[model samples]
Target: MIRPLLLLAAASLLLGCAQQTLRGTGDLGVVVERATGSVQIIETSHQTRLARIDGLGDLSHASVVFSRDQRYAYVFGRDGGLTKVDLLKQRIDRRVIQGGNSIGGAISQDGALIAVGNYEPGGVKVFDSKTLELVADIPATPLADGSRNSRVVGVIDAPGRRFIYSLFDTDETWLLDFSQGNTPKITRFKNVGKQPYDALLTPDGRYYVAGLFGEDGMAKIDLWHTRRGVERILDGYGRGEQKLPVYKMPHLEGWTVAGNQTFVPAVGQHRVLVMDSQTWKQTDAIDVAGQPIFVMARPDARQIWVNFAHPDNHQVQVIDSETHEIIATLEPGPAVLHMEFTARGDQLWLSVRDGNEVQVWDPYQLKLLKRLPAESPSGIFFSSRAHETGL
Candidate 1:
């Protein structure tokens, strides 16, 4: 009887050990399954899907941010669902619907707060990163007529525990400093431009620039010198050219900086604009296959990969950073939604929405490495983003 009991106890111990295996999340990432309202957990090292988590609401335009520890992912859905996903446990730890329509979100410098921007109600909400509890709710500035609150866009995490964003309806930019307490000290920069559609923060977190959709330029604000106010750059960039109809708006977050030059997509144009990082002046414009949607740089900044909007969405063009010329053009498939590079830039993963799979590529050789199945994947986010200033 004692020998039989001992054997059963030994079998139970082995089962417990097999069920809990230790691993690291450095190579782990999540791919947004937009159509199914799910996310597939993937690992770069193996180039495979580990698991798929579902129940995330309305992920048509979803975005993700990682916790400081890289063990959790905060998914911001278009339906205003803020979900805290446990990457290790492969499940959602918490979820809350904080607004009517959410566009995107960002994590604080200290990783204690998560800020989300909304489109319907028009405001930014801050929540405790750990508990997902509301910390602060900042309504967007009202229009001159006091009709409605401006729609918040370009929400990004900056250094010094600050959050900076643009006002689409009010033509303004704001900086919310939370270094003090839960109540933030707000700094408003008015008359930024005609319509600041989207914005991007430099990798170093120094300059925050907003792209104007209603005008031909961008608005720049130097965080180091807030007293200098907003300076308009690339003014009259499309002065004489007959603009084409933009089927889809370009994403400023995809703006890339290679060497000393910044590459940005020109709205309603089939060109990628290159500007000097120091002077903020247009250096050259490289014509591409179509209206540029995401103009992103390789992790090492050696090449620029560009995707396009509808009618030309089937193509992707690569540009040589130093030569400012088209190096190669490849057709991955229709609806090349997003591109993400590995931490060291060795592998490039692209979400081919129409193809219903994510293609892994060797960026240096421009060779297809592997393909992982996904359900209408749109965004591919890695754990390495936790350390980046503005992802």
Candidate 2:
């Protein structure tokens, strides 16, 4: 019995050494399997599925951000679970329940801190990226009339060691500055707009924009000049118009910039609003087939791709960034949730939730390149995204 036990130990040691030799690449990407609380890691260059890891908690609305080294992935689960996964090993390194309900998270510019926005207790929590230790707990303070805890969304890292988020109940936006110490210096801007659901920071980390759910415009904050306060842009752009019934609120994450123009989705309207980043004004509106959910620009910035809300989600439309005209519309099957481009924009991956597959397409040729199966997939994020700002 002693001899057999020694042989088993030797075999285990050899297996561990074999696993250590396996290496991961920055070109690899992950697709969320929301139904099973799992993610499938894939090699984007070859369009090959590598492995599927399960047991992640409540991934119904999961979002992922990577560390600066691109070796660790921080997955924010809707059930308030913050999981740190080692991409090289394809396993979870650490996990903790930081809140009652969570929306998403972001890693600091220096990669020392990870901040998550909560909905239940309603505030932001900052943690040590490496140790998963709590560093700060910022509660969204109540309003003058004593409203309930405001749901926090779009917590994004800024250039100056600061994080920005919006409070849904108070109708205000706050900047939590952690530059000096772990104790965040809170600065609040009042009357930004009603129900600012989600936000986006430009690639340069200069502008932070929030979409208003209760109004027709969006609130923009120039982080470069915080004293100017939150300025309203595209104010009442949809006023006095007969708008369609919106099945889902347009996602600000879908809004993107191409060349000199930033394309944004018009709420409850079947159109995409174009804004000039230089002039900070609404320049044009492109009519689409349905209510736009995601207006994303490919990595090359040569064309913009648009996806729609339910009932029209089966269609994907491509627009020429220069002419702002619809060039092609392809049927990518049902429940097309998200899209991601390769590092150089050579290949575009589309996640089809209902179809249970991810389809890769060649934009110029307007042809289907390949299709891979996924389980209720939503977001497709790559490790190369770590080097980009406001991912």
The model with the greatest lDDT is 1
All models, RMSD in angstroms: 2.0, 3.9
Alpha-carbon runs more than 4 Å astray in model 1:
1-20
Which candidate comes out best when scored by TM-score?
1
lDDT of 1 by residue, 183-288 (tens): 9999999999988988889999999999999999999999999999999999999989999998988999999987799999999999999999999999999999
- How well is each residue in 1-391 modelled by candidate 2, as lDDT tens digits? 9999999999999999999887657788889989999988888878989888887889988999989998888999999999998887889899999998999988888889999999978899999999999999998967567665888988888888889988987798999888998898899998999989988898899999999989899999999999999999999989888888989777787688776889999999999999998776999999999999888998888889999999999999999988999999989999888888888888889999999999999876878999999999988889998887675
lDDT on C-alpha atoms for all candidate structures: 0.94, 0.89
The residue pairs found clashing in candidate 2 are none
Which 10 successive residues of model 2 have the least lDDT summed? 141-150
> Candidate 1: worst 10 consecutive residues by lDDT?
15-24
Estimate candidate 2's alpha-carbon lDDT, on a 0 to 1 scale: 0.89
Please provide TM-scores, in order, for all candidate models, with all chains considered together: 0.96, 0.93
Count residue pairs with overlapping backbones in model 1.
0
